[model samples]
Target: MTILICNSIIILITKTDPALQTPMYFFLRNFSFLEICYVTVTIPRMLVDLCTQKGNISFLSCAAQMCFVLMLGGVEFFLLTVMAYDCYVAIGNPLNYTIVMNQQVCVQMVAASWISVIPVVIGQTYQIFSLPFCGSNRINHFFCDIPPVLKLVCGEAFVNKIAVYIAVVFFVIIPFLLIIVSYGKIISNILKLTSARGRAKAFSTCSSHLTVVILFYGTASITYLEPKPNQYEGMGKLLSLFYTILIPTLNPIIYTLRNKDIIVALRKLLAKLLA
Candidate 1:
């Protein structure tokens, strides 16, 4: 609920404020919407289970949940990569920033980010669910994540494991590498600015995004990339909780608190409502 409300405020403020009608805030709006969807996929069900003390989910329902999770997660990686490129262009090539990242281009990139994941997620979900589940039905984790679901498979899951690894490389690692490259260029460009104030201002624009990137990629890398041993299963769940729940909650606070534009826009909005 906190995630939803906070992110909704971002979306509302961005849409209503003319000053925020730029490429950066446009991407930020989409990201906040994505965060809302991302949390909704897992947290609500988790909450209900906690309340009822009966964490029961049907096989098809679990498959659907996992599919949405994978899709949303993939979209987030792509969106973050797009955002990194946007930052690079704004800082590295300011003259062409508006021309390059026009409204149509931004919409296309966002649409591609969303659509590109469908086939990959569907194929992966189908492959995982097609396997026989003759073993214990209980999922060790809070959600129907790939790792925990794979554990319940009856037969050898070598192929499934390979597919998952490939997906992670293509969707997660590759995007992260692209973000790193974009930021590298951005940093180089920022340093070239002769004026200290110019450099500081440039850094300020990126600080919020950089913080979000670290919070997201840091927790995600630890959760997904690391070897999942039985001894670390408990640790794994805790890490999953961080990425899935904590990150979404923090994102709105990070952006709104760090961004002066958002702060001013929010204040104006509040004053207008009160008046």
Candidate 2:
């Protein structure tokens, strides 16, 4: 998976001349880098547990894994929201897109997304880690997911529950609502275009982004937003797979497959390679 994702990023980064430094491409690279980070942060540890003779992790390692998974998950979701806004601006007002989304603003937005997610991650991780896990040593899922892992703890998990709820509202629900609002405005603007052709062109630009948002939010809403009982262990693991493993793989494909410019760029690069 790592090799595959690395090759994909290399192809994307080198598809055009090195000087093809537009904001859109820059955002693509950022997303690509995040995807790579997202996978690396969890997958190796997961595969190790599955493949190793004895799947054992120390308490600290488990805590670290949970924290990073939270950070990456939150960061990726917020980045998606930021990308939606970027698309909204690009399509809603093409002439002023560059000026409005200048380098400083872009950098600051990306940085803020990462920064904002850190506290949520820390809060949630602390909530889970502070509990006493005296029951189960093995995690049901391949990864150290909080909800399932917290069940192993033989303590009052009320603090963790409250913190997780607060973090969910702040990190996931609120940003998801913003994505919906932004897309609504974008759709409105696209519909107001003078002709069918213009509206189609504008809508095409955001469809890929919308697809990602749905997949992320739909799976996540099921996994985190819904209540989980101890008996529903299988469902918890399944939801974990959806957000962590599945989404990372699909995110790159969604961006590259539906993006017309990326397709054109890849074809040009391939032709040059063959020549």
Candidate 3:
């Protein structure tokens, strides 16, 4: 709840403040919005399951939850990739940064990230459910996730597992590769700077985002990319809790606390409210 409120406040601050009207903050606004949707998708259902102690989700509801969670997860990955490009441009081509990442381009990147995942998620949801679920209906995890649900299937889900592998490759691995490439260039550019202060400043600007990327991708990879779905069922749930529950709460802090612009904007907003 606290994280959701903070993310909402950040979104409002980014959208309303003229000083934050740059490509970086614009991306931050969308990322904050994504965090809200991301947590809402799973946390409410988790709470309900905890209270009821049954953890039973209807077939349709489970499918819907899976689709929304996958869609939002996809969007976050793509948005982070776009953010990496934005950061690379800001550092590697400072003079052309504004021109390169103009408002229209930023809007289009965000829109594309949100829109492009619809078909993919639709296919994934359909594929996962199309398989046989003839065994116990109780989902192992607090929320309905693909691996735990797959474990409940009466028959072999070899093809479904393969499909998940493909999807993970395209969605998770590809974006990570792009981020690496972007950061490689960013580092190269940073190293070229002679002034120690300039290099430190550049690295400082990117460190928060890099930290966020590491946290998000690390847990997400373990959740989705384990060699066998059933191998780490217990560990998987813990990892899922970290990413789905904990990470959203940490994101607002990660992005804002190191951000001077956000600090200044927040102080101004506080002053305005106090006045």
Worst lDDT window (10 residues) for model 2? 2-11
- What's the distance in Å from true for residue 94, model 1? 0.9
lDDT values for all models: 0.92, 0.78, 0.90
Q: Write the per-residue lDDT of candidate 2 for residues 1-275, one digit (tens) a residue.
A: 74355436644654354554666666667777777777787778777876885778888888888888789888878888898899889988789988999989989988998998887687778777877779667776677777778778897788777877888888789999999999999988997899999898888888887997898888877777667556677886787788777877777777778777776667777788899
Predicted candidate 1 versus true structure: per-residue lDDT over 100-153, tens digit per residue: 999999999999998899999999999999999985899999999998898888
lDDT of 3 by residue, 75-141 (tens): 9999999999999999999999999999999999999998888899999999888877785777778
Ranking by lDDT: 1, 3, 2
- Residue 133 CA displacement from its true place in model 2, Å: 2.1
What is the TM-score of candidate 1? Answer: 0.98
TM-score-based ranking: 1, 3, 2
Between candidates 2 and 3, the lDDT winner: 3
Cα miss at 48, model 2 (Å)? 1.9
Q: Residue 26 in model 3: shift from native, Å?
A: 0.4
The TM-scores, one per candidate, come to 0.98, 0.92, 0.98
